[model samples]
Each structure stands twice: as C-alpha cells, then as structure tokens.
Target: MPSGPSFLKKFTSLILSFGPGIFAIGYTIGTGSVTSMIVAGSTHGMQLLWVLLLSCLFSGILIYVYGNYTLLTGETALFAFKRHLKWGRVMAILIIIGIAIGQWNSLMGIMGISSNIIYEIFAIYFPGISSFKYEAVITIALVLTAVFYALLLVGRYTFFEKILVVFVTIMGVSFLISLFMVYPLPEDVIKGLVPSIPQVKGGRMLVAAFVGTTMAAATFLSRPLFVKGKGWTINNLKEQKKDAIVAAILVFVISGAIMAVATGALFYEGKPVTQVLDMVNTLEPVAGKFALTLFFFGTLSAGLSSIFPILLIVPILIADYQSGQLDTNSKQFKRITAFACLFALIVPIFGSNPVEMQILSQIFNVFVLPLVILGILLLINKKSIVQVHKTHFLLNIGLGLALLFACIISYNGVKALIDYF
Candidate 1:
C-alpha cells in the first residue's frame, strides 16, 4: 500500500512515539536493580533468581496497564485519580506524598551508592588520594544536578526524549560489556534460571529483603509520569503496548545480567556485601577495576538521570493538589523543586544508614503499590474514560495478585522494622 522508504519512516516514527515507557524503565532499573542484584548474589547466591524474573514480569504488566490507562484517560495517574476519584483525594494525596518522599530517599541512596562505587574505583587506580573521595562525590553531584536542571529548563520535549534514548543505549551497552567481561560459568549460571527459594541463615529477613529488592514499589508507581510525558492519547493503545513490551524486556535483560554478574563474581568468593559498594569491590577480581568503573558510571547515569523527573514530579503533585491546577512554569513548580532539593540534601545530613533508608523506603513503597494499582485499575475502567478498554478479567487477577504479594511483603517488612527498633 505504500513505498518502502515511506513505510519505513512511518514505522520509525511509531517506534519513537514509545519514548516515555523506555524512560520509565530507566528509573526502575537504576540503583534499585543494583541493590537487588547485589542482594540476590551476595546473600543467597542466586537462590532468589526467580524473584528477579517474576518481579520483572509483574512490573512489566503493571507498567503497561498504567500506560494504557493514562492514554485512555488523557491524564496522568495523579490527575486522573484526583479528578475522577474526588472522594478519595485525601488518601490519594497521602499516597502521592509517600511516593515523593520515597523518590527523594531513593535519589539519596543512589547518590551514596554511586559515590561509593566511584570512590572505590578511584582508590584502585590512583592508589594514594583517599582524601579526594568526598570532594569527588560533591563535585559529581553538583555537575549532574546542573546538567539535569538545564535539560528540563530548556523545555524541549525532544531533548528529554533524546536524553532518555542515549541513557538507555548506555545502559544496554554497559551491561553487555560487564556480562561479557565477567565470563561467568555457563552451567552454574544456567542453574540460576530454575526458580527456588534460598535457605538464608537469617531466613525471613533475607526473604523480605529479596522481595524489597525485586518488587521496587516506587519504581512501579513512577511509570505514570513517563507515560504522560509522551502525550499519548486513547488512540495510541497499540503503539503504547509495543513500547511497554520493548521496555519491559529490556528491564528484564539488563537486571538479569546484573544478577548473573554478581552471582558469578561474588557468590564464588563467599563475599559479604551489605551495600552496593561491596558489590563493586566484589567485581574487582573478575571484571577488573576498569569494568567496575564502567559499572559505577552506569549506576550513576541511571540514578542521576532519574533525579530531574523525580524532583519535578514531587512539586508538580503538591501544586496540582492545593491549587487544582497544572502549570509547569509557575511559582509552585519552583517551590516544589526547592523542597525536593532540600529533601535530597537533608537525608545525607541525618547520618542515617543510606542502605537501610533505601530498604525502609522500599518497604513503605510495597504498602503503597496495592493502593496505587487499585486506583489505576478503578480509574481506567470508568465509563468516562475508555469504558471499552476496561481491564479484562485476567488483568484484574494479575493486579489482585500483585496486591496480594505487596500485602505479604508489607507485613514482613513491618515485622523486620519492629525487630530493628
């Protein structure tokens, strides 16, 4: 029906339209995946391999549903929930606040993790200047934040789109490099493919940690912003689905490679890695320090890229709630951004265990996921939206299962917190 070049151009345009979901994948697969993979390897030696696979599958489905819901409603998840579910606005507001706090906490955790990895590699190469580590982290953070702000301030959707594409490219390449260089044993690694729970000496705590790492509740909730950013409408369901499929598959692949690397390198050494930096050090022998440096850079890119959008969303949520308006270029936007920046800076000042904060926020996130999914499912199925695109029975069942799993993890995490206190 069309000429070859014309058809190819249209196809490329269609693919480009799927930008938002791919970008959302960046947020989830960042420091979150790093922590999760490290936990899987260092603690149980791939005993929780099934968790990674299962969570990715479930997360992919959730992302697709959220994207589709946004497209059908022509509104972001927060706006849709607020406008249509006015009675539940208070609860929705609370959940949004929780997500915002979670984002801030996550940004800090990512920074700490990235800096530690960078510092470790620097120590290996330079071999003398331990004094430079803190200064290096500060310098890196400032530069990164400035770059993120500049890109957003430019107010060009195309720039955001290109940044996301480049990051995804880097992520894919960096992972492949690590995977190849690590040279993992094929048979033992293949054994990890079979799903089975590990017998951790500390038992339930380890299991809960595994769940926290794999599930990544806030990452799931963050999908709506990226989906909305693409400006897709109800007419774009098919293209959106394709985007979700590609992005989800990419997440599974990248995260799986990370777990494999950790398992091959650390599990064999019988190393203990309570934090992400430990994971970096564990890889030193197998992939060498250079490869580890690449890994840290990759981790930094993942974390830093997420900072702008995450910081932006918190203010956006707060402003939209109080004023019943959505203005990107308002005083409210600037105020919210300041608050996010303050939150980002203040967490490190508290001198708390950054890793523990990440774990705690993740647990809190699990408690929030079921409610968010419930809101998404309910809002998407409304007649005013695309009543025809209402969630099918199987989709309902999957969301129900995700909710059920979230509840289980929440109960476990709360118990762990109680024990900690």
Candidate 2:
C-alpha cells in the first residue's frame, strides 16, 4: 500500500487530470441551464427532465469527439473547420458570429439576473433600501463584469480551471442541498426519467431550450480549446473520454437538482415562474430562507463561472480563425476579451427586458446547433485530417442521430421565435 503522502499525490494528480472536464462543467450548468431547467420544472413539472438527460448524453459524445479530434490533429475546432474541409472558412465565420451573438446575449442576461439576486440579498440584510432601481442594478452588474474580467485576464489557463472548479463545486453543492430540502416525490421524479413530452403550451420550446442550453454550440466549440489548452494529445484520448463523462454527469446532476427543486417547491403548488428571480420569492415560501439563500448563491456562482468562459471564447475563436496560438498575454486577446465583456453591458444597461433576452439567447443557441453538428460531422469523417482517428461505424451513427436531434430542435426553436414575433 502507498504511504499517506504518496496517496495524496496520486489523488491530486487524478483531480488535475480532470481539468478539461471541470472547465466544461463550469462552462455549462450556468445561468442558461439553471434558468431553463427551473422554468421547465416550475411550469411543466418533471416532464422535461428526460430532455436534459438526452441533451447531456449527446453533448458528452460531441465533447469527446471534438477533444479526440483536437488531440489527433493538434487543431482546435475552428482551425480544423477552416483548414480541413470545403467551405470550411465560411462555416468557421458563421460559427464565430452565431456563437458570439448567443454568448453576448447570455452574458448580459447572466449579469442582469446576478445583480438583481445580489441586490435582493443586500436588501434583506440592510432593510433600508426602499426600492430597487435599474441604475443600481446596472452598477452592480458592471462591478461583477469588472471582477470577472480581472479574474480571466490575470489568471493563466490553470488558474482559470482551478477557480472554475471551485465555483462549480460550490454551485453544485448548493443546488444539491436545496433539492434535498424540497424532497420531491419519488414517482414524479422517476416519471421524468422516462421519455415523454408534456402537453403544455410552449412545451416544445422548453424542450428546445433545454437541449440548446445543455448541448450548446459554445460548449462544443470550447471543448477542443480546453483540451488543447491543457496540452492534451492523442495519448490522452482515454482521459478525454473520462473527462467528457464527468462533465456530462455533472451537468445532469446540477441541472436535475434545480429542476427537482422547482418541481417540488413550485410546480406542485401551481406557481408560475416567469423570470429567474421569481424563484427567490417562490422558493422562500416553499423551502424557507436557507434554501432560498443557497439557491441564490448557486445561481451567482453559475453566472460567474459561465461569464469566465463566455469572455474567453471570442478571443479563443479569433485565435483559431487566424491559426494563431492562444496567448492570453497578447494585446489582441486582452482587447477582444475586454471589448466583448464591455459590449455585453449594453443589454443590461439599456434593455428593459433581461429575462426575455436570456430566454432568447438560449433559443438562438438552438438555431446554431445544426450548423455546428454538421461541421463536426464533416470534419471528423475527413480521412485526410482524422486519418486513423476517423470515426467508426457506430460513432458515425451516433453523430448522425445527434445531427438529426439538432435539426429537429433547431426547427422547433425557429418556429417558436416566429410565433413569438
């Protein structure tokens, strides 16, 4: 048997090996997933939990595939697309544009919601703030944005991963505890595990949002980048698969816990949750102050965790597009990150409807899914690029089914947007 110190070293190495997956968990399970899951459970009950499971499973497969492709080719997703296939450059540009728009919208929404939650917490303690004001909320959001930017700008990739692991852990634990407090009915929860759609209005849209957020384009785009950033190679394929599994499981647990809490505390009582903050009021009456506070902290952590990756994505995408190394210290990288973070402020500062913006961002993400899936399919099958690492028969089938799933969700997402407009 190993000595205590040796055991500790091994444990530390194992945890460190999980960096890419931990980063993925942090990137996902953010405001978008939290909001979507809560809305689904609060309004539609546990009927949509199966969608979350399906999405996470699909996302896991894609994450592994992307990471494996990067390891084999030493190319990030964008560079692979741009340099490998026909019309690859055009596809890369479209992906960059689509992801940029979706991420920017999400960043604004996350900041807005996080600020409101913080302000509400402050009001509870002080009992002196008479009314909530937009200006005050915006100011809080700017501060949060500044803090997020500083953390990303000053930290190296490992620092970023370590911080995110901490945030994701806090958020995951908080939500898990909150879920236990609710104690959802076993049968209802089990029913959610069985695949069946609810007959509620906007049910399809909710399904789309759940899938979109869980299997987001940004998640896939960032997976290879994380793999490459961690200096993973073809020899790390097994580790990459393990990491993907960990991330997928984390996504399901965190998302499922939030949904269960919402279902048991709100849906069982027939309460409607139209906005993210609406849960604060509803959860308090159902699960008490402690649960409410825990939920808020979880959401705040999620928002911060999400914003870190959202800010890095644009810079990373630009680097991939230019076939350049991702140098965090580079002036271009810092400038791009800053500009993206600052530009997102426009929504929270000037827009009157942040909840709508958040929902729209998720819906827009679905529209981008089919294109990304198609690109991944095309790139992974290219014999010249993937070579011996080319996808096998079963893997291709899985990718095909995932592509089909993306197409169906994309169609529903578009229909929902049109109906709303």
Q: Would you estimate the TM-scores of all the predictions?
A: 0.84, 0.93
TM-score of 2: 0.93
The Cα local distance difference test for each model comes to: 0.65, 0.82
Clashing residue pairs, candidate 2? none
Please, what's the RMSD in Å of model 1?
4.4
lDDT of 1 by residue, 1-421 (tens): 5699899799667556556765656666767556756666665666666666666677777878877766665566666667788555865677776777666777777656655555666677887767765666665555555556666566554566677666766766777687777644777666766866555444445456555545555554545555555566767788778877777787877777777767767777888567655665577777787778666666666666556556666665655455433345666676666656656654344444556556555555565666776776677567777667656888888888877776776787677667666
Q: Which 10 successive residues of model 1 have the least lDDT summed? A: 319-328
lDDT of 2 by residue, 152-249 (tens): 77848888888887788789889999988995788888888898766667776777778878888888888887887788788888888888888898
State residue 400's C-alpha deviation in candidate 1, in Å. Answer: 1.8
